[model samples]
Target: MEETITPTRIFSRWRWLYRLILIGTVVLSSVIPVYAQSEPLRIHPALLTLAEESPNEIIRVIVQQNAQERISGGTLSRAGAQVTRELPIINGVVLELPARKVIDLARARGVRWITVDAPVIPAATPGSSCNMLTNPGFENGMTQWDDWENTLDKQISGHAHTGAFAVRLGQPSGAFSQSLQSATAGGTYTASGMFQRQSSNVRMSVGIDFFDSNWNEIDEVYTEIPPSDNYVPVSIAGVAPAGTVHMSIWVWKDPGGSLYLDDLRLHSSSMDSGACAGYPATAGYNVLANGDFEAGTTDWWLNNSSLQVTSTAYNGTKAIHLGQAAGSIAQSAGIALPGTLYTARGTFHRPIGAPWSGMGIDFFDVNWNEISDVYVTIPETSSYAPVTVSGIAPPGTVHMSVWIHKNSGSELYIDDVSLVGDEVPDAFVQSTGTNQLWHDAQPRTGQGITVAVVDSGIADHPDLNIAGSNNSRVLVSEDLTNSADKLKDAYGHGTHVAGIIGGNGSASNGIHRGIAPGVNLINMRISDGKGMTYASDLITGLQWLYEHQAQYNIRVVNISLNSTVPESYHTSPIAAAVELLWFKGMTVVVSAGNNGNGNGAVPLFSPANDPFVITVGATDDRGTGSLDDDVVATFSAYGTTIEGFAKPDLVAPGRNIVSLSAGNNATVTKEHPSHKVGSQYFRMSGTSMSAPVVSGVVALLLQDEPNLTPDQVKYR
Candidate 1:
């Protein structure tokens, strides 16, 4: 006999599954180390199978200790015979010791694991011997530049004498100097560069500062620069004093507006020097080392527990796969000078979004204090797209960090990250036409209409609240994960999805306002934070929504989550349940899933693939408001379902979308700093974020004409 299992029966099965997970957590917590909690032990598996075949006499390794125990100096006392050198402790002291001792160190007290610290061999620097000044071209940003006085602004720009970048000094007063460590006493040197006057009232000059054997400044000379937008070639000759021991070159501008400098060269007066090709003439080199990930995880440091090398690369043979947004595969870019403009580039992909995920480069000052950080979102894609973050590094900046971070629980793959001097942001979405379409509609903002969110639970965000009251517009929340837990969001997806529907943007000063800000919300949560959910739980949530639809004025239902079972509307219970809700006087909208955007023939997710429901796909709005730039989101599932219907009723903006955050402990808030829209707003992606947008619009339509049937709503 054909049978049916009601929502109550599914609840009983869920209780058992929850109990098993709870029991497993209690059992594992005692065995795992604290660092493992942040990231797992990354011990190269070959270490346990060590043999004499290993080359190299000495190898570098990082030893991590347990949380409570400190790694004392005597921890590796047995390895004294094999120890060659000791570097400063970062994760731990980088030790150059025999590879044979690795197994022995693994058994040492408090040692969690030993990781091979392979050194990154950078691309050779040409013209090293010919150039007397360290960082003469401003290639390493400010690696060798002196900025202790801190009177003026120093930054990197794309305008160069011959290359793609140059250093610019702005405002009041300050100086940038490169020290020539080695110079024969009494020797003559010539300093030449591309210079430009950019609004500074006072003249900018280049000169040399001579120091005697005792480190006292004994002599100084200067050369003046004329005002110009284009680069003006200038040079100055200086002779080391009789008692001079060392010298430093300086490019200075007095209090005024700005002076730009680039392609600087300091050489013995006898040899002639000129600007190299314009693209990279200043540094004439890429400062970011090993950016292609060709050497495995050699130069990249793991933030989460996993090694990053993957087969999904944009250019090279390998890439980095990331899980947690908390930690990232990070590497230091060449030194970045304060106030210099920098451009970052990379490619990222995630089939199932959390695309609030992004890669970023952070600028740090000479004192190692953070000056500024910039990030660019990685849209959900089966392939990849370019991401860029370009801005002027804040004052006192001397270095930068390039890392990849995104929404936690969302898997991300990154490849070919490089930070150069300058910026051109690839637009994430459009801003025009969207406002006009909604504002010009009848009934305005879905005022009295209510939407039922039958997926994840929404959080109590300040902007999502019903104006003055402490309660949120998200009403009647129920956590299907556990009866013991409150109807609140612990895993982060639902809050962001709901925020996109009716968030008021109170916290973000209206910068991230939702589609239907006036619509009421009823959160019926079924999924966990990472968005993992079962079909039974979803069916139950839908059934419960049916029972309580009258208690709340739920005119629209949004299901951004999906199931893989591709049964027809005639055979699928979930499809029948949603259709019943539609007939009961509510419009249902669902996500087409991420599988659609790939090149292969993608099948629609169940229920969404059903002909009746409004299955929404995603579109890349190109960070603009006009429809001219819009294209279907690469990850939104499309094509015909097994039910023989071409689905995805429509497309909506889903790339780099910003909305309200779910407070401090929320997943997206903690893991994806790159997606932070403001103190209270966040950015995310996917058809999951797209579906609610349609639901909100449906709410507005329903408000305009209250008695519209499901067929009428679909037709509209």
Candidate 2:
């Protein structure tokens, strides 16, 4: 320094020294300060552990007060506990620390803290959990707030946390200010949590607040919360205006002190969208079944060509085990175009664990080869499930075969098969206007005539197109047994009777037309497959027909089926009812029992034998009528009534007489084997097949004289 250096060099060196000093100061200030406090006393981890482990114990303090008085007057206590420094004070005793004392203690302990502004309440005991303190009268500090108490007595004590707390509350009158936070506006919100109250009578309220972008309170809502486990839904419409929204829930204590809440969560709106639509139309027709085979046996016609309708035994069975394989020709036979749509259906039920079983319908052409098959698999439930088949061959001379094959075990069943199509017109009487048989009189048009048909039921056949004036042709039909569900012909008998009485005037190949084509029919179904009908149901049906005769314009009643003659013919309820209807100017035409021999000795069945009923006997195509019938049908029972009336007031073509079935070209089986084909004109023999002929004749007569009484109509 003593040596005189150059001025330029000295100035450069001084500038360098100044920059170094400035950098050193900046570095020192950023990294570490000279006067910063170090190593302040914090609550010890051991003490915190002790406090948590034994919450009921009070904490004590021993402070080393420095000359700077930094640790002077230091105290230790639980945060929310009340505290007092006195000679009588005891250590490890739980007490509430006042707000001032808590702040003072925290400051002395070198910790920044805020005390709960409200009066401090002691927390629940160690190993205890409960809502210990409810709203305890912030309105009035003077009033006692511990009157109502929730005391949870320990029911089971084993684990550390098995204890519960006692909560107390004081009733107050004024509205309490509740500040809430963090709720969104214009959203669907559901607040649900489990809450248990010590007592029943308690009220709760949930408060919410909405804020704007400026942090200003925009709106507020208050709702009452019922004490239950079900979700309480609350909705907020419109926007919250983008600020901190607030929400708070409060319980208004009744006599009960506390309520508990657990598992609380909030959910946002879901963004899902979808729905349901509708159904489709059904598919085409099928052949359900044909009756030519035995079910559950090797006797299927396909396996055995020599199957005949004879008494035989197979598979350890005596009689024919046709089972569901027995086809009902009456129910299934029909006419079809070359290619048409149809469905055949039947039902079968078997016990649990039974072997697999199925039903099928076979269609045969004129040569009787299997052209098509409709089959169904049986389910092993105790209920009937419908089996179906569709798609059939065109109209021709065809026969159906129903088959049931069981792998093992027996089954119970009911068989129903039908050719589905638009209904063809049924055979009906054409108007020949003459009141006399075989006359060339002009048939009248549009004259109202009613024929009552009591049988299985009538199909809406095309041949019987006589609709009532109101378009309601079926009038006063009642099922006495409540068994016949609809006017469906389970047996072919009803259709035959209907065709004979009032068939529509449509015929195929000069066949299937009935006698009285113009008359309307009132269908009454009174029997099931057993060929039995209850007397009460029959009486009710007759009474209904009688009562509504005027409305229906019913002029004649055709009873094609007969039961065994009651012992007393005159006092029989059916006879009485028949007489009453006859007296009411309605003619009753009955079938003379087919039991009579050429000798006139056997009396016909009752109702038929009744004086008021017109008893009709049978005839053949030869026009040679029998004394009752030419040769009595073997199955037809002989009549032996005390009434000395020789049966069969007259005869009609019953033997091999062709008639209408329920549907077009329906097959009818009778005593004659010649009637088995699908020919529309079937050769049938029964008083059943005969009575309808007389009914049609009556309709023709009524067409000429509308007001004829029962007696006059019969006499004519």
Candidate 3:
């Protein structure tokens, strides 16, 4: 107690310690950065990607309970967004909001930001798209796929080569394939699939099937899938047919077989996804499981139950030998899509020349409709010849019947059989204006959506790079006009519009191109050669497009016309039709008119004046790529219509745009001879050009956001 009474001495010592602590605090504060202490943005990672890639793009979003009210009040209502979906569960709403407003929604009251409605797949490799196969890895366990008729032995198990599960083909299985609806014919492609088998008794193979427009087999190539302890890989490289429209993958396993397959991938050299990056070649399967007939006639069925599965090998350990007169054997093929090409090849051995009436393969549809004039045969001879059946698959063909006619007691042998297919190639580097915008934007190229071009007509060209037997041009065509065929482009304007929207630039060495190069096109010819279009013809065309939108996966329609007489969309038939399309979940893009902006007076026209559609105006991007000096085109119409709604929902480049040319186009030839870029391309201007550019961007938007409504597209 007596020592504590010395207060002045203790205070002096405590002051020194306090001064030292203050100095240390100042020193530490100077070393640390303010950002290091700040909290990170509390947004989903994928949502953040939205901000970076497609800021103006509107998308669906899910929120927490009671968050709809706050989100709509704070973000949707303020931004004039329309709700795509409003779910009562968890009080959720799938709304299409501008990508920029995502953060605002995150900050709103009572708004707990759940993730995006769909998984935001990261942008793919700059030039490559995502895998196009459905149920590719058997993860969904036999969904969206078809197997052999003898499917009783196939098993879906967890022993996957890649993914959660794979289908195991055990003892008595034929080819397993899914119809490739979107395959591009004439494109170079590579295919690889994994297989696993611990035993040596089973035979495995892989192959590529070439199919024509009628699903007929054009040509085929087969390779063996090797065996492995875990999983082996097999692959084939080839070019698809110019007439081939689609294809199918065939996985075959020999009778009494046991193998597992997973991670089947088809890499397209045309789309620039050709690299296999350490793809396995050993222990992989082939296109034909028992192409050599070494598997003892397990997959080959006896039509008459009189054929012998003999060990009389023809370049193999086993072959099929006829046991009785008129005896036959056949094997079923994998189901193929319409317009695919395939080929069947085998060696027929005949030790004794017999009077066999017929020995060839027959094609049939799923309904068992046998096709005529599409088979290969061996004539009466003791010597053998390599027989081949190569032709376009007839329409509705699902199976190929290969059989031998054992006439006059002919002892025949068949061995070393195989089939393969492939696709054509397309070069994107020929496309001009394909710059950082596409690279930095969301990774999609209007792959799934289709655009309807309502104009004069569309012509087929290499620039279009269309898929299938059609060569990527004109999937569907309607000649609403009386002057020409569905594929005729009398005025050339329609072809120019189509080229700007989806030209892959096969003709221009990749110079002139469209926005969504991979998107499909539907041509609705509604005008005459002199560029004359009537309201009746236009309406009829629009009606046809609307009725068959589902058939073509039509998500967008492009109208580059104008109406001189202004009327409210509420009363106009054409405008009403546009509204119907919008309501039916399609984005209708119309030109904002090239009527000189009506001097800011009567600037609106027909369908473009409608409030529900996406009206596009034109901006001159100069001769350069930068937008720094961009200005609204003098001829691009803009202003409030009589209905009291201002328009030009979006603006895009329209000046001096180079696109596909309808050869010998009267209007183009007379008006713009000097603007030609190449044999297939010509330059044009106006809101007509701008409208298609916007339509293309809409396709890209729909690629990743397919659920977006027309109002959503307009708002975006």
The candidate that achieves the highest TM-score relative to the unseen native structure: 1
lDDT of 3 by residue, 223-339 (tens): 877667888777787777667777877777777757788867675663331111111001111234566664576776666556776766566346777755676666665543345
The lDDT per prediction is 0.62, 0.43, 0.61
Clashes of each: 27, 42, 55
- Worst ten in a row by lDDT for model 2: 271-280
Global Cα lDDT for candidate 2: 0.43
State the weakest 10-residue window (summed lDDT) of model 3. Answer: 119-128
The stretch of ten residues in a row with the least summed lDDT in candidate 1 is 273-282
Q: Which residue runs does candidate 1 get wrong by more than 4 Å? A: 1-434, 437-443, 468-471, 483-487
Residue-wise lDDT of candidate 2 within 1-716, one digit each (tens)?
Answer: 54443323333333333223211111112111122333222222222232333344333322211112232122443344443312110001122442223223433432211211111000100000111111221211212232222322111101111111111223332222223344554443333333343344656543434565454777655555455443233322233333445533333444333443322222223101000000000112232333212232222233222222322321111222223232322233433333434455555455577666666556667666657776767677765455666555556625555555565344334333334532122211222222234344666422478888877666555556543322434544556545534436544556667766665435453345566656778888765533345444455567677778888888888887553322234333355557667867788988765444343454454567676788776543221111221333322323445555545676654544445554432222332234332534333445665677778788777877877888998778
Q: In terms of lDDT, which candidate is strongest?
A: 1
- Off-target runs (Cα >4 Å) in candidate 3 are 1-434, 437-443, 467-470, 484-487, 597-599
lDDT, residue 456, model 3: 70
TM-score of each: 0.43, 0.36, 0.39
